[model samples]
Target: MVGLRVLTCGFAAAALSVAGCSATGTTGTTPSGRQATTSNPAPGSPSTASPADLARKQASAAYVGMWRDVAEAAKTSDWRSPILSRHATGDALSVISRSMYADHRNGLVAKGAPKTYPKAISADPSAGPTTVMISDCGDSTNWLKYRKDTGELADDTPGGRRAITAEVKKAAGGWKVARFAVEAVGSC
Candidate 1:
């Protein structure tokens, strides 16, 4: 049960972080001090987005999407939701599944969605990147677990802001969150 709380709360923080990172369109500095920007082509222009830019955008989207999928599954404690695989893979997927399974067994369900602010911190290879590192300050203030049978809060700990990091890799389908780590509450 303690592990389940950590997983549920931790994932909410991670999701918030990823969403914030991707949605702000803020410029980030890479490990080498290079200025990296995440922006998309205006309208339907010639699509002048660089490979690095595209990778960052896609990776950020996947990270944010993973959180959304997890939130959806958490509502019903459904670990086997097919949507989980759409944006997550590897350990990222495994952790979410395990968390949801535990929630199901314990008769707990999560409500609300997390808010993420994710930024592309780094990309492997300046040109034509295949992996992107994301840093985020996720807020899980409103996302929390509840007892399904009684509709009551399950944990005493309230969610809050936390720091999160994720590695998104290019997969056969598309960019996917390969792994992520969420710190304890107030970590941000």
Candidate 2:
């Protein structure tokens, strides 16, 4: 009975694996005759990503780039850095500028860059998206504020992962972050 149960369980697991593969429309043959899986498209089908998918990718990239640019500018508290404008605009740009300006006023500078993992939550007009909403968990443990003159930590608090949401728009120059709100640390 034990041996029979083991065999039945193995068959059931194999059946589930096959079912999952079929559900995803993925099928290929490995050199060893085992099944290989690919994304979305079956063999010989067009693998081009849809317009909405492309927009999502572009918007996510822009959102992440904005964080990077802001971090770079924070290193010296350069609120006027042109790099900030490259990936951000409107409310997003204004927020970054204000934060950097405040940091400058406090004689503070950031020493490291925050890590961002941005995902596209939604895209308008599924066919050719003009706007995308992004959700992110931004980790800033390595990024910390420090005093510019003494090179010492600014406060007793430490940075942590936070939840972030943003809106990105398709502009003539490509995708740009229009607005973003970051929640408190540990919110992620």
| Candidate closest to the true structure, highest TM-score | 1
| Model 1, TM vs. native | 0.77
Candidate 2 global TM-score: 0.75
Candidate closest to the true structure, highest lDDT: 1
Give the range where candidate 1 is weakest over 10 consecutive residues by summed lDDT: 13-22
| Backbone steric clashes in candidate 1, count | 11
Which residue pairs clash within candidate 2? none
Flag regions of model 1 displaced more than 4 Å: 1-5, 8-46
Note the Cα lDDT for every prediction shown.
0.77, 0.72
Residue lDDT tens for model 1, 22-128? 22245889999999998654532236556666677889889899888888888998999999999989888888888889889999998988888889877776588
RMSD list, candidates in order: 10.8, 15.6
